[model samples]
Target: MALIGRILFVALFLGSGFAHITQAEAMGGYAASKGVPQAKLATFASGVLIVIGALMVLLGIWLDLGALLLVIFLLPTAFLMHAFWKETDPQAKQLEMIQFQKDLALAGGALLIFALYSGYGDNLGITITGPLF
Candidate 1:
C-alpha cells in the first residue's frame, strides 16, 4: 500500500508538471486574459516551478522545499486566475472562487505530506501491525 501511494504521488506530480510544460503558451494566454502582466514570463515561471516541484516530490529530496514552492506557486494561481474580481460576472466569479478553494486544498495536502514525511522514511511511517482475521 505504501508503495502504491508513493507511486501514485510521483505519477500525479509528474503528470501535472508535464501539463504545465506542454501547455505553457495556453497558460500564458490565460494569465493575460486574467490581467497578469508579462504573461509569457509568468507561464514560464509556472512551468519551471511545476517541474522542479514535481521532481523534488518524486525524489523525496527536501519535501518541505517542494511543498513551499508549490504553495507559493498556487498563491498567484489562486489569486490572479481564480479571485472573485469585480470585473468578473457573479456566476463566473463564484465558479472561479470555488476552483481557487480546491487549489488551496491541494496545496494544503502537499503541505500535510511535507509536514508528515519531510524527515521520515520513504514510506512516511505508514504501518500495519497485522492482517485482519
Candidate 2:
C-alpha cells in the first residue's frame, strides 16, 4: 500500500512534467498569457524541476529538497496561473479555483513529505536514491 501510494504520488508530477517538456511551446504561451516573463524559459525550468523533484521524492533520496522544489513550483503557479480572482466568468472562476485548490493540496502534501522525512532519507530503509531501473 505504501509503495502504491508513493507511485501514485509521483505519477502526477511525472505525467505533467512530461507534458511540460513535450509541449513546452504551448505551456510557455500559457505562462505568458498569465503574465510570466521569459515564459519559455520559465516553462522549461518548471518542467525540469517537476521531473527532478518528483524523481527525488519518489526514490526517497533527498525527499526534502525534492518537496521543496515542488513547493517552489506550486506556490507561484497556484497564484499566477490559477488566479481565480482574475476570472470574471463564474464557470471560469470556478475552474481556476479548483485548479488553485488542487495545487494547494499538492503543496500541502509536499510539506508533509518534508515534515516526515527531511533528514533521514540516507539512513532510512524505505527509500532509495534515484530510480530503481
Compare the candidates by lDDT and give the number of the best one: 2
Worst-scoring 10-residue span by lDDT in model 1: 124-133
lDDT of 1 at 65: 71
lDDT of 1 by residue, 48-111 (tens): 8877875665565665576667777777787778877654588987898797997788778767
lDDT of each: 0.68, 0.83
Indicate the residue-level lDDT of 33 in model 1: 92
Which regions in candidate 2 have their CA more than 4 angstroms from the true location?
Answer: 119-125, 129-133
Per residue, candidate 2 scores C-alpha lDDT tens digits across 10-120 of: 899999988888888999999999999999888988999999999888877777778888999999999999999999999999999999999999999988777666544
Query: TM-scores of all models?
Result: 0.75, 0.89
What is the alpha-carbon lDDT for the whole of candidate 2?
Answer: 0.83
- Candidate number achieving the greatest TM-score relative to the actual structure: 2
* TM-score of structure candidate 2: 0.89
Q: In candidate 2, which residue pairs get closer than 3 Å at backbone N, Cα or C atoms, i.e. clash?
A: none
Model 2 scores worst on lDDT over the 10 consecutive residues at: 124-133
